[model samples]
Target: MTGTDTDSGRPLPRRLLAHVGVAALVYLGVCAVLLVWALVVTARETTDASMAGVIPFLATAPASLAFLMLPANSVVFFTAIAVGAAVNAAIISWCTRALRRGGHPDR
Candidate 1:
């Protein structure tokens, strides 16, 4: 039996929501890792006099691009992050819904 067969008893919206939660967690995990990496790099470069501190800023680019493009405030930063999470969740829901609808080929 295929994965879709197993989803027969469950509602699609519930499945989609579950997928959204999973996608949010995965997205947050990636952001958390990058944030930690940036912090570590910043700490290691503290004694240097180069422009390496920019690395942390670059690392957060994906999560904060909205804020960077805007007024660059805490509100904007949080908004960007929230928007990112929502977008990620929506994309995941769409893809998983398609998959559950048997949008795959079998050999």
Candidate 2:
């Protein structure tokens, strides 16, 4: 197995980048859906619908780190989410790879 991958025949780093990209895209998609919901709420309820936009950040465990590290700004929030997505992807990739190796349960 390459240091990057175990048996998938793909480089681990590339897989990691792809995972990060897909995960970040999914996170952004959630943000977009929430944004749309916020817009709809704003149009219907005449309220800012702050919760709609903030829920993803507040609810997603990974993003909470970014949210806390940075200020409450849109660009920063998105960046933080993307960064959080990468961190999450890396962690998940590592965990899954470790599990697949099948050495010791305690390891």
Q: Which number leads on lDDT?
A: 2
Score each candidate by Cα lDDT: 0.57, 0.59
Of candidate 2, the 10-residue stretch with the lowest lDDT total is: 19-28
Give a tens-digit lDDT track for model 2, residues 1-107.
65555636677867655555545445556656765565577567655664555665553456457467666777876666556555665566666656666897664
Give the Å error, residue 29, model 2.
7.4
Worst 10 residues of 1 by lDDT: 48-57
Candidate 1 vs. true structure, TM-score: 0.45
RMSD (Cα, Å) of model 2: 5.9
Model 1, range 1-107, lDDT digits (tens) per residue? 46656665678866654557565456556656654565576577666424443443443455445557688554664566556655655666667667766946541
Clash totals for all candidate models: 0, 1
In model 2, the runs with Cα more than 4 Å from the true position are 1-48, 104-107
Q: Which candidate achieves the best TM-score against the true structure?
A: 2
Pairs clashing within candidate 1: none
